[model samples]
Each structure stands twice: as C-alpha cells, then as structure tokens.
Target: MSAERQLTVLSREWCHLCHDLIEALKPLQAEFGFGLQVVDVDADEALEARWNELVPVLLEGEVEICHHFLDEGAVRAHFQRIG
Candidate 1:
C-alpha cells in the first residue's frame, strides 16, 4: 500500500470518547491495512489549540471525514474513493 493510504486520528488526552472512535475504526483499519496514528492534540500546542474542541477527528492524509464521532458510512466511502 502507498503511504497516503494511512489514517491519521486527531485526539486529545482525557477524552473519553477517543476510545470509542478508535474502536469504530477497527474494521476499516484492518481492511485497508492503513496505519492508524492517534495524535494527541495536547502534545502539539498549536494542534491542541485548533482541534481541542474537535477531538476524535478522522483523516486520510489531509482529507477529514467526521469529527467527534465516527461516521462509518462516510469513512467507508472515503476509503473506497481512495482505493
């Protein structure tokens, strides 16, 4: 698979729902064989500042799908488009 196929997830420490988001993505991750990076927004001051309120955001490269929750259909469509 190409590097762009990887998935980036922006999350924050102390966020309870981040786990939910990750769990929701399990199937897609396995199917696409995409690397999942959970970026702690708190670690980057700027990112934390910008996306603090938008935790649990899913991204494929720079393409953002849903924030605050996993939209399975939307995410699946995104992966299909990418593939």
Candidate 2:
C-alpha cells in the first residue's frame, strides 16, 4: 500500500447497499490491509448534503473509484493499479 493512499467508503444510515458493501469488502481490507474509512453521510450535515444522493461512493484520495454500486472487479483492479 502506498503510504499516502487510503480508501474511504462514503455511505449513509439505513442504506442496505452500504451494509452489503461493508460485508463484501471485509475480506479485501483484511487481505490487502487497505485503510478503509466508512463514513456515514447522515452523521454529518455537510456529508449528508454533499453525498446524500451519492452514498456508497468509493474514494482513493480525491479520485472516485465507483459509486452507488460496488463493483468488486473494478475495485480490485483499482487497488492493483494504485497499490
């Protein structure tokens, strides 16, 4: 992992997709040791406003990995390229 590279999953409360993502990514984080930050959009007003409709967004620094849907293949590919 790059010293400065980290993964953040933006999500919100009562989001089943977010739950699914957390379930799906547990292994990846465990395997590759990617720093994962799951932020609940609803927890903060600013986050809620910015990402209220963009929940489940994956971010590597300022670059977006994907959004709404979790594409495991794409995510793995991104990690490989960025790792």
Candidate 3:
C-alpha cells in the first residue's frame, strides 16, 4: 500500500458543522490512515473570501471530496479508488 496522504478541511472555529465533520472523519482516518488538517478560513484572506460560506469543506489535494458535511460513502470510495 502507498503511504497515507493528507486531507485538508477548510473550516473556522465558530462553525459547529465544521467541527462535526471533523469528528465524523476521525473513524475514516483510522480506517484509511490519512492525515487530517483543519485550516481556519478566517486566518487567510483569500481562503476566507473563497470559503467563508463553505466551511467544513474537505479536500484531497485540490479535489474537493465533500462539503458542509461528511460523506462517509464518498470518503470510502475515494480511498478505495486511490488505494
């Protein structure tokens, strides 16, 4: 198997949905073995502008896997495809 990759979550501290998504992804991380990174959109001007309304965006590289919520099926499929 290839080494695990990093998954990015575009988020802000105040977003409960964002936090929920992160919590949901934890089990997926354990199963698929990928690193999770949570980025605060408010910390960067462009990221804030681009993703302000789209908090809880999940990405593998530049490809957005899910947004607003954690799609467990899609996440499994993505890892399966990449695996």
Error of 2 at 65 (Å): 0.9
lDDT of 2 by residue, 1-83 (tens): 54355788998768898888877877877777778888887888987787778788888777788888888788889988865
TM-score for candidate 3: 0.91
Residue pair clashes in candidate 1: none
Question: What lDDT would candidate 1 get against the real structure?
Answer: 0.82
For candidate 1, write residues 1-83 as lDDT tens digits.
Answer: 45446788898767878889998889877776778889998889988887778898988767788899989899878867866
TM-score of each: 0.86, 0.79, 0.91
Better model by lDDT: candidate 1 vs candidate 2: 1
lDDT of 3 at 81: 88
Per lDDT, the best of the predicted structures is 3
Which of candidates 2 and 3 reaches a greater TM-score?
3
Please provide the root mean square deviation of candidate 3 (C-alpha atoms, Å). 1.4
Among these predicted structures, which one has the highest TM-score? 3
lDDT of each candidate versus the true structure: 0.82, 0.80, 0.88
